[model samples]
Target: MTEQPNMDAGAATGTKPLAFDRWLEHFRGNPAYHRLIEADIDWNGRSMLDEPTRQAFINSFQRFELGESGDGKRLLSKAALEGDPTYLAALELLVREEQKHSALFRRGLDHLEAPSLEAHWSDAAFTVLRRALGLRTELGLFLIVESVAMGYFTALAERAPDPVLRGIGLRIATDEQDHIRFQIDRLRQGFRNTPRAGRVLIGMAWTVIAGGAAAVLAVDHGPALRACGLSPARYWRQAMVGFRRAAHSVLANPGAEPLGPLGKGVH
Candidate 1:
């Protein structure tokens, strides 16, 4: 298969807007893209980290795996109500890719001789808070989550002690960025007709949500961040940086560049 999806992960630039249909094609064609990533992660059940660092990473990883391990049934039910066949179909494939992230992390844990966790307070809290906001699936929440993930994985790739974790980070970073932009495009479409003042208000709300999520994650995943040579504060800042870029792309303009990374190969 192709090394990358066949579409740029287009989320409109601050000066333009992105289309949702392109995202559909990207997910449609690359259904099992994780297979490509797996070939490169050849860790045959080896613990590559020292004990102290290994435990920290395992603690953090188990939480991430728990979040990614969903089957998307809840979300698909929501999509069915929305009656958007295209998005529903794309989302089904997207969920598979998200599950792949869990699978990859699970494999890493097994290789490290670690057990996946049954639950995490942060995961539960995030869910509670997300549903607590009663808006049309808000899509902005996905933007916040994936934005954090993209930067978090990049840190793992650059600073983690283990080559296998680094490989998984690098591979998953691509998918996470695409996921971020997918949500961005969807949000952009929803707000395309709103007045500038309304968009600004929405952006402000989004930024606040992003900030809150970033702060909590900084604390929630602090140990792994430290193990990987990234401080919680620094990781939080990096997450905000990505979120701002995405927010501007979605709420700034409808005639600018998109965060298109699918066909172009994600950075």
Candidate 2:
């Protein structure tokens, strides 16, 4: 695989190059792993499914592909202002990985003869909301989406009737797990300096946001979740697990070991 052009590398700051040095190293090294995944995974496998299952996947995956296609221009600008060169580099790499996911989903859609939308109402709404807030608040909202994605993909991987869809979902789920960890780490760093009262207020606000997001996902993608043998209630519960984990990581103890898969391999 060809390397992506490096984003402008700014000078490092503070005693440590980045507060999340370990995560930065992992991000820098992930492209090789991603390339191996791209080479090894069979994106072209034909689905052997009944009409309902097939239709559900087509509906679900296309929307997900569009959501993954964002350029992250705002996120890049926000991170650039943080004065942490390593963190900015990691974020850039993160954006690239998401683009790769978008590409994978698009290819899968082409194979299935499904059309991906140029824009989704949900995507447009999310972009607008994210841009309206500062980086911290934006990340709070981002964590909510990541949480829902984690649940959705995990369900698809475990329950999709088509072997091909299951394989694709599994790969994406693996990536999402890593993404969740990265988000937690960055959120931890971002909130490290907040006072107790401030942390409390942020946590309260995030809880409300996460609840709303979970409800929206449950309603928006209920059919897809049902196809994967999950109830909307169950899916919402899984999303909450991710939400609480992120909140605990940020407000309680940023250095704590994660509650679930560290998905981030330590080199």
Candidate 3:
């Protein structure tokens, strides 16, 4: 947003790529988000209930999916209507994939006999935000949220103990990784086409939204982590290291050359 050098260009020219130092810098400055991932892992491992607690935990987890997928569908529809063809197509694919995720979670909930709540509130929130700030801002918010979710799901997949849960986590993680790539590709194109001032505003908005969401998750899940054998602070440090390594892979990948323009805002 601040017109950083084209970080992906080196990869395009078959040269060594720019490192993810910027992303790591961003992550280090926001331990709150890392804490959320750690707490989720801790909770899933410890507080996730044997049977009675499973209902409540499943309900909460379902609500989270409902909220997230509802927002994703709305954002995708809006993007299809207003964005470029390539971007919109990718977003549509993501939307369909997210629907599958939603259904997958719903199946799990149903198998556990969990109650379903209306997800209209999530849609309402997205609509309000879009009306207030326009499409690009909404997309930025979506991307940041999706990125955090990707990291969370990936970490959970790596730590899950139960075979079924591990399988689900890994599947969701794969979807999330694809979602991240789609968002990165579209956001990069958007940044290239956007006015410098507008890009800055969107980046700032994304940072705020991502940071706020991370804080909320950490607060909600921190106690759960404490209940587990893991310390929240320690788990957070480990997760950050993992996230940094993943970010490095993306930043250094040859295929990510097209994302050069948006590199500054990727973390």
Top of the candidates by lDDT: 1
lDDT of each: 0.72, 0.72, 0.48
Arrange candidates by TM-score, descending.
Answer: 2, 1, 3
Residues 1-267, model 2: lDDT tens digits: 111122112232233322556666776777677666557556667666677766776777778788899899988897787667777787788788889888878877776778897887888888898898777667767877887667888887789666666656776777777777777766665555556777787788788888888888887778889988999999999889878876777679744443333553221
Give TM-scores for every candidate, taking all chains together and pairing residue i with residue i.
0.84, 0.85, 0.60
Model 3 TM-score (2 dp):
0.60
RMSD of 1: 7.0
Q: Pairs clashing in candidate 3? A: none
Greater lDDT among 1 and 2 belongs to 1
C-alpha positional error of residue 132 in candidate 3 after TM-score superposition, expressed in Å:
3.8
Q: Which ten residues in a row have the lowest lDDT in candidate 2?
A: 1-10
The total number of steric clashes, by the backbone 3 Å criterion, in model 1 comes to 19
lDDT of 3 by residue, 1-267 (tens): 333222234334554433433333432333343333334432223334466445533644565557545535556556555424444555555565566667656655554567666754544665576555445555555565566455445444555433334445555665565455544554453344345556446455555565555544444444433333334455454444443333333333325444322221123
Per-model C-alpha RMSD: 7.0, 6.3, 10.8
Candidate 2 C-alpha RMSD relative to the actual structure: 6.3
